[model samples]
Target: MNIQTVGVIGAGVMGIGVAQNLAQTDHQVILIDISEDILDKAKYEIRNNIRLQSFFQKSDNRKTPDSILEKIDFSTSYKLLENADFVVENVTEKWDIKKGIYPQLDAICPQHCVFAANTSAIPITRLASLTKRPDQVLGIHFMNPVPMKPMVEMIRGYHTSETTIEIAKQMLSQMGKECVIVNDSPGFVSNRVLMLTINEAVFLLQDQVATAEDVDKIFKGCFGHKMGPLETADLIGLDTILFSIEVLYENFNDSKYRPCPLLKKMVDAGLYGRKNGQGFFVYQ
Candidate 1:
């Protein structure tokens, strides 16, 4: 099916990026959140991000920020999603919060509307079970800064139909993204390895092995990685990293996935990395 009108759940960092990217592609977007205040904040962020992208990328063919913003309808009502042909959920990674949204989405979205879970560590199959259209539910794990990223991790749940996979691929392609298909698993490929690395990085900081800057420098200078695991954790948000680690630990029953105490402490203090103001390192 041709997906022209898309629904994006959550108005957080990822959701705003997704909605912005879709609008730039000329697709109509309904961005839904729980409150008008959050939606208002999202609108302001998207406008700024679009302007920044234009300045940094210097692309002559890109749409104006005003035109792009016009394509998105930010609302607090789920009823706005009634006509959405596709829905990509980017809510918090906690299972309890996520479980509550799917059933509502199933009731509200059209039968043919595909549900893509843009999650970090949750099992797509488990999320699919909550909806009657298991075959229509899959995972489309877009990386941070969705517009700048060129690739995504497309996860196929146990009952996700091949047709659903094709539709997701088509939509991603429309957004100028390529995807690598992978089977369902907690954390999938990206976070399964990434969260462990970030957790270990936190442990190293906790052990005073090196300062956060030194640790990130070693990864960038010596390992040829663009960003160190600690910096990455900061970019992903400390709270999100902690939650992903907890999910992996519980799912695998592995000690290695246990979240570092320092990570938990920071999150409890409300230093949620770039989103807030501080985490492993402070942001301007």
Candidate 2:
């Protein structure tokens, strides 16, 4: 549980953010991705985010851009992760994609390394079953802005050990984050409730109950929520929302988890929210 080095899989939004979070704490980080181009973009974004933070906020362990960037090793190979003490996987949410990686991770990583799945709705128990180290597999659901978020949803699979949970908490403590540990279920706790609200907001849009702006305003103004469900969906990505909802519906066999048609159509049209500039609303 010393955790000197960390390995991060995927270079998308969450992957990059997680790498930045680890690097900012001066942890030696190995970030792996299939594309060098995407890796480059992730590095640039990490640097940009760090620079913005330095200007806007004050902290005790603030790192220079060079110092923070120096801690990270961006690679196109999984072999670089062999020495990592902990590995966080933030790959796409598709089951097939996860099935492919978990087996590979089980084979490649050191025997003692723990695998944390940064998933939205996929059950930790299911992912754990795919790997040899079921007791070492758990969920560490970091929010969108990993560096800024203080709370991460820590999930314990059916076979996960108490020692693994404590080690995960220690690692999160190093990054100045607290884990809200919860028992594993279909969507766990966060997405099970949040996704339902987001899907219902989509239903409102589908039924033409109100404009997106009005719907979001009602939630923020009347309910005193930070972001509306439709806006949250946009931030989470329509495709991701649809995938999580499908997983919920399939697991529970309930009609309440059904995805709104507009959500599917938006994803089909390639409008994936802030990452692409369009979802429930235009980004810019």
lDDT of 1 by residue, 1-284 (tens): 88899999999999999999999998999999999999999999999998888877976687887899999999988998889899999999999999999999999999989999999999999999999999999999999899999999999999999999999999999999999999999999999999988898889999999999999999999989988998898888988898899999999998889889999999999989889878888889
**Index of the highest-TM-score prediction:** 1
Q: What digit string (tens of lDDT, one per residue) describes model 2 on residues 1-284?
A: 79999999998889989999999887999999998999999889899989987876787877798899999999999988889899999988889888889888888899999999999989999999999899999999999778888999999999999999999999999999998999999889999999999999889988999999999999999999989988888877788889899999999999999888888888999999988999989988
lDDT of each: 0.93, 0.91
Off by over 4 Å in 1: none
Specify the poorest-scoring 10-residue window by lDDT in model 2. Answer: 54-63
What residue pairs clash in candidate 2, if any at all? none
Score candidate 2 by TM-score against the native: 0.97
Residue pairs of candidate 1 with colliding backbone atoms: none
Quick one: best lDDT, which candidate?
A: 1
Candidate 2 stretches greater than 4 Å from native: 59-61
Candidate 2, residue 144: how far the Cα is off, in Å: 1.4
